[model samples]
Target: MGRKTEQTMRTYHRYLGFFLAGIMAMYAISGIVLIFRNTDYLKKDVQVEKKLEPQLTVANLGKAIHKKNLKVEKEEGGLIYFETGTYNTITGEAQYLEKRLPLILDKMTKIHKANSDHPLFFLNIFFGLSLLFFVVSAFWMFRPNTPIFKKGLYFTLGGVLLTLILLFV
Candidate 1:
């Protein structure tokens, strides 16, 4: 590309990189946190209580309480007991303990999960498009004839290859 195009691309790349630095760091941290989701790596249990529909059946009770397995340790005197807590079969008062990530990390991790209904959905779209722009603009950071540009191409190829291997293998 011409000098003007290269300079323009570099300007956009540099300024946009600076502007998105904080969000990028958050995305990175959230991604790392998600890797440990299968376990309670950074989570805590909190007591939860909810009043559900009364007189629910054994099956419906689990659905209402939003628990899997729904094992009834014992039911006595219109109450059902389970691993986490107990439930009132007559009045539908359920108490349980739920594990949750802390507030700040929870909110951070939610950014990637934002759907069309979320306000951050627009931010997701904008960040994604800006990332595409960054990829294209990176080529303009150095002239194609330069040694560093050639080395960058090699590194880019290695990165793409490593990603593909990790994705499919």
Candidate 2:
């Protein structure tokens, strides 16, 4: 590559690395948390109150509250009881006790799992592109003939091999 192109890559890579350091840390932490999501690690049960659409049926209550497999276990007077909490049919109020990670960790996990329906999806795309740029620009950081660059290639190959092994095993 041209000297100018290599210089540009190095400059942008350095600045982007500095800019994205915090977000990268967040992704790493959140990713680790998600691996143990099936367990109750770092979780506490808290009461949550939500105002949903009024006069919802038991079948639709789960969708409104964003829970799955939720059913009304019983009904007494104006309240519908479920495994986690109760909903007042007369009003649009739902009160549930749910186990969740702490607020900040929960928010981080939400960002980590953002979909197309969420605004954080754009951030996901940007972060993915930034990571791709980092991978490519790293090659420009050192000349291909250097010992450091040769050692880096060996490390990169090892990483790729490890990833493939984990994928199949």
Give each model a TM-score: 0.89, 0.83
The stretch of ten residues in a row with the least summed lDDT in candidate 2 is: 63-72
Backbone collision count in every prediction? Answer: 0, 0
Model 1, which residues run further than 4 Å from truth?
57-70
Over 4 Å off, model 2: 53-55, 76-78, 90-92
Model 1: lDDT equals: 0.91
In candidate 1, position 117 carries an lDDT of: 95
Q: Alpha-carbon error at 83 in model 2, in Å? A: 1.7
- lDDT tens string, model 1, 1-169? 7999999999999999999999999999999999998899999999999999888877898888777778889989998888899889788899999878999899999886788999769999999999999999999999999999999999999999999999999
Candidate 2 per-residue lDDT, tens place, 12-82, comes to: 99999999999999999999999999899999998899998778888799988878889778998889999
Best by TM-score: 1
